[model samples]
Target: MSTRPPFTLYGSNASPYSCKMRALMRYRRLHFTWVPLNPMEMASHPNPNIRALKAKVIPVLEWPDGRVLNDSTVIIDALEAEFRDGRTVVPPAGPARFLAKLLEDFFDEWLMKAMFNRRWSSEVDRDWSGRWIISDQLMSAPELVTLPSPSQTSGLIKFFRDRQVGRLALVGCEDDKLWQHVMYEVVGALDMQLRSGDACRFLLGPHPTCADFALFGVLKQLSLDHTAGRFIQDHFDAAYGWVLAMDDLSGLETDVDWKSLHMDTPAVKKILKLISAMYMPYLVANGKATRGEWVEVEFHLDDGQTFRHKEKFGPYQKKCLDDLKRHYEQLTAS
Candidate 1:
C-alpha cells in the first residue's frame, strides 16, 4: 500500500479545470476523494478550510493536513514536487519543459474562449449545460445520488444560463464567428499532431504532459457539448479520441527518455504560429493594461482584425506572462 496521504478535491463535474486536476491526480495515481461542489456556494462552504479560500473556484484541493490550494496549474506543480513518481506531467527540463508550459497556458487562456463560447452561445447548449451543471451539483449531495427534479432546479438553471450567457463579451467570446474559426483550426491542428505517429499521441511525446492535461480540460467540454462535439466528431477524429484517452491514464506508463522527445512536428509548428498571432498579442495587451499603459486591452490579430476588451484586465494573466518570460530568460543557450 502507498504511504501517501489521501487528498480531498472539491470540484464540480461541469468545471474544466476541475476535470483537469482530477485527471492529473488520476494519472499520478494519487489517492484522493472527489467532492463535487457548486462554485456559487463555495464561499459559504461548510468546511472552514474551503470557506477560507481567497478565490471561490472549483477544483480546490485540500491536503490531508487541512491546507487548501486552488489554481489547477499551481496544484499540478505542487503535486509534481510532492510526488517523485515517474508519472510526471512536466517534461524533462529544457526547451521541452518550456514549450509544455507555453502550450498549457495557451490552451488555458485562449482555447478556453472557444469552449465557453460553444457552451453558452447556443440555445441548445446553454439549456443542456445549465440543466446538467445544476443537476451535477444537486446530485453531489451524499443523500441525493439521483437527478433532481426540474421543478427543484428550474429557477436556478435559468439564472445560471442567463448569467453565463450575459458574460460572453466579458470573456471575449462574443464573436461567435471568430471563436468558431479558432475551434476548427485548433482541433484540426491537434488532429494532425495526434495522427503524426505513435510517439505524437501526446503533445510532446509518447507520454502526456501538463500541456496535454490543459488541452484536455478545454477539449473535454468541446467533445461533450452538443454543437462543438458534433463538429469535432465530424471533422477531427483523432483529437476527439485523444480527449477520451486523457480522461484516465492511471495504467499508462512509459520510459522517461527525455532525449527522444521532440516538439518540431508540423502540428506543433502550426499551433505555435497561431499562438504568436493570437494569444501572444492578447497577453501583451493584457500586460500593458495591467501596468496602466491602457484603459483596456486592444490588440490586432494576424487576420488584420483588431480585438478589444474593456472589461477588467486579468492580473493573473499578466502574472502568467511575466512568469513565462522569467522562465525563458532562465534558459541557457545551448
Candidate 2:
C-alpha cells in the first residue's frame, strides 16, 4: 500500500504552464486534485503554498510529502525522475533526450511571448480571455460565481489589458508583430517537419514527450484564442492537427519501452535545426547579459532569415540555459 500524499496542482486556466503540468499529469495517469485559482486568489490569497512559491506563479505542485514545487520545467523534471519507470515523457538517454529538453525550453520560453501577445494584444482577444478567465475560475467560488454586468466585464477587461500590456512592454514585445513573427516562424517549421515522411504522431516519436506537451500547452492556447486560432488554421493547419492528437492522454498510457526506441532521426534533426539556428544565439546572448556583461547578437534561422538584437541579459533566461546545460550534462554522464 502506498502512503504518498495525493498530488495536488494549483494553477489557472489562463496559465499555459498550468496546462502543461495538467496534461503531463494526465499522461502519467497520476491521481491528483486540481485547484484552479482565480485572479483574486492568485494575487491576494493567504495560502502559505502561494507565498512559498516566491514567484507568485500558478502551476505550482504540492507533493504528497508536503513539498511544494515551482516552475513547470522544475516540477516536470522532478516528477519524471520520481516516476522514471512508468510511461515517460523523456528519453532515457541520447541526443533525442537533449533535443526534447531543448524543444521544451523553446516552447516554454520563446513561444511564451507570442502566446502572451496573441491573447492580450488585441481588444477582441483581451475581452474573450478576460471573460473566459473570470467565468471559469471565479465561478468555482460560491461568493464569486455570478455573471458580471456589462460594465463590470468591461472593467475587468481593462484591468487585465493594462496589466498584460505592461508585461508585453517590459518583455520588449510591445510590438505585437515581434511575438507574432516568433509564432509564425515556429509554426512554419513545425508544419514542414510534421509533413516530412519520417514524421511521427508526436514530435520525438509515436508518443508524446516533454517536447510535445510543452508545445501542446502553447498550441492549445493558440487554438482557443480567437486570433491565434485563425492564424493557425489559415497558415499552418498541419501543426494544428498535431495539437489535437497530443491532447489524447488515454492513448499514451502503455508499457512501451522508450529506451528500446531509436530517437535520433531525421524528424528530430529538422526541429533541432530551428532551435540551434534561431534560439541558441539569443539564449547565449541572454545568458551573458545576466552576468552583467553587455552583448549584441545576430541570430540566423535555418530558413535564411536573420535577427539582430542589442540587449542586456535576462535573469530568467539565464536560468533556462543553465537548466538545459545541467540536463544535458546529466544525460551524457549517465
Candidate 3:
C-alpha cells in the first residue's frame, strides 16, 4: 500500500556489510525488497545494475530512480544525506563524528579479521556456522536447514571453508591467538565504555550512530556464528547487549532532538590509544608499501602481546586512512 517504489537490495546473509545496510535501511523505515543471492548468483544477476557492482561485493542498493550504490559505508552516507529530514545514524558533533567514523573503520577493516578467524579457523565452527548459512541462505529448501549430509552440503562447505580460511592470512592474523588478542582489545574496551558513568546504551549515546551500526554488522554475525557467538556470550555481556540493542529500531524518530554528544572520555581515549598504537602503525606501513616499497609493521597491544606483518600498500585501507584524516581536518576547520 506504500506509494514509493520498492528499493532493490542484493546481498547474502553471511555478509556483514549486507547486514549493516539492511539494518540501517530497516531502522530508517525505508521500504526495500531484499534479494538474497549467493556470490555466484549475485554476479550472474541479469539486472545490469546488480552486475555492475563496483567492489563486486554484496549489499548493493539500487535506488528507485535507477541509481546503483555499492559499499555499505557509501550507501549509508548517501542515505543520510538524502534523508536529512529523517532520523540519522551519524552523530552531529565534530569530535564524536570523527570518533564514530574512526571506530567504524576500526570495526569494518581491522576487527573483521577476528570475525573471519572465528568463522573459518576451526572445523567445529565451520561445521556449525557454515551449515546454517548454507542451508538458510544458499539453498532453496528451508526444511534442510539442520541436515548435515545433504549431497550439496560438502561442496558448499569446501567452497566456503577454503575461501574463508585462505583469507585468514590476508587479515594479518595467521594465528588464532593473535585473532583473540584483537578481539579482547575490542570487546574489553567497549565493555568498559558501557559500564562508564553516563551508561550510554549505544556507543555514542542513546541513539544508534554510524559507529554502532558499523560494529553491529560484525557483532550480529558474531552473535549468530557459533564460535564468536559463544565467545561474546561467555565474556562480553555488555557487548552482546549492545549488539541486541542495535538490532532494535523501534522508537528512533526523525523529529527527535539530536544530542550534542562528544567523544572525550576515558573509554574513547582507551579505544583511540589502542587504534593509534596498533592499527595506525599498520596502516602507515601499508601506506608506505602502497608507494611501491615493501614494508613490515609490528603491532604491540596493551596486554604486552606483539605481532608483525609484512604488507604491500592496500588501496582500500589507504583510502580509509585518507578519508579519516580529511574528515578530522574538516571537523577542526568547521
Candidate 4:
C-alpha cells in the first residue's frame, strides 16, 4: 500500500489525453483517485485550482499538496521524477529515448488530426459521441443517482457537437482526404511493427514507453468511434489489439535490458520516414509562421502534396518543435 497521500486526477472519458494519463498512472502504480469532470464545466469549476489553471484542459493532476499540473506530457514527466517505481514510460537516455519523444510528439500533434476528423465529421459519429460525452459528464455528478435523461442533456450535447465541428478546420481536420491517408499509413506501419515479433509488441521495444502511451491517447478514441473503429477492426487487427493491451498494464513486469531498446526495425524506420515527410515539414513551417503575423500555415510534404491550414499559427506546436530540435542536438556519438 502507498504510504503517501493519494493524488487526484481530474479528467473526462471523452478526452483521449485524459485516458492516456489515467493509463500511465495505473501502469506506474501511483496512488491516485480518478475524478471525472465535465469538460464544459472546467472553466467555472467549483475547485479554485481547476479554475485557476492557465489552460482549462482535462487530466489535471492535483498533487498531494494541492498544486495543480496540466498537459499529459508534462504531467507524465513530473510523475516520473516523483515516483521511484521500476516501471517507467520513458526509455534510458540515448537515441532510443529521443526517438521515443519524437514518436510521442508526432502522435500528439499530427495523428490527433485523424482522431478529431473522424469523431466530429459524420452525422452518426457526431450524434453518438456528443450524446455519450454529455451523458458521461452527467453520470459523474456527485448527486446523480441514475443515468441522466436525454431531456436533461440534449441541448448541451448539441452545443458541444456543433462547437467541435465548427473548430475542425482550425485543427486541419477539414481535409479529410489528407488525414485519412495519413491515418491509414500510420496504422498500417504500427500493425506491421506489432506483428513482427513478441519483441516488437510495444513501439520502442518489449516494454511500453511514452511513445506507446502517446499513440494510445489518439488511437484510444479511434478505436471507440464509429468510422475509425470500423477501419481498425476491419483492416488493422494487430493495432486494434495493441490498443486494448495498452489500456491497463498495471500488472506488467519489465525485466528487459535497457541497452536492447532500439528504433531500427523496418516498421519503425517506415514510421520515422513518414514523420520526416509529414510532421517535420509542418513543424518547420509552423515555427516560421508563428514568429510572424501569418494568416495560414502552408507546407509541402515529401510526396509532392501540400497542406494548408487557414487557422492562426500554433505557438505550442512551435515550442514542441523547438524542444525536439534541442533534444536532437544534445545527443552525442556513443
Model 2 whole-model lDDT (C-alpha atoms): 0.75
> How does candidate 3 score on lDDT?
0.75
Off by over 4 Å in 4: 1-3, 146-148, 291-310, 332-334
lDDT of 1 by residue, 69-188 (tens): 999988988988887667778865788888989999998888998899999998999988898777767767776757667797899899989999998876678777767867887889
For model 3, the superposed segments whose C-alpha errors exceed 4 Å read 1-3, 140-149, 196-198, 253-259, 291-295
lDDT of model 2 at position 256: 49
Q: Which ranges in model 2 have alpha carbons more than 4 Å from their true place?
A: 1-5, 38-46, 175-177, 196-198, 260-267, 291-296, 302-304, 310-312, 331-334
lDDT accuracy of residue 232 in candidate 3 = 88
Please list all clashing residue pairs in model 3, or write none if there are none: 290-313
Q: 257-291, model 3: which lDDT tens digit per residue?
A: 45545565455667678788878897777766656
Model 4: per-residue lDDT, tens digit, 1-334? Answer: 2568889998887788888998888888787899987655778888898888888777899999998999998998898787656787776577877898899899988888888988888899998889777777777888778875778778888898999999887666887777787788788988988777564777767788888888898899899888899989999998999889888888887764667676786567888877887788778877888443444656566678776655557788899999898778766644
Alpha-carbon shift of residue 328 in model 2 (angstroms): 3.2
Query: What lDDT tens digits, residue by residue, belong to model 2 across residues 244-288?
Result: 766658555567467645455454565566677767877887876
TM-scores of the models, in the order given: 0.92, 0.86, 0.89, 0.92
User: What lDDT would each prediction earn against the true structure?
Assistant: 0.81, 0.75, 0.75, 0.82
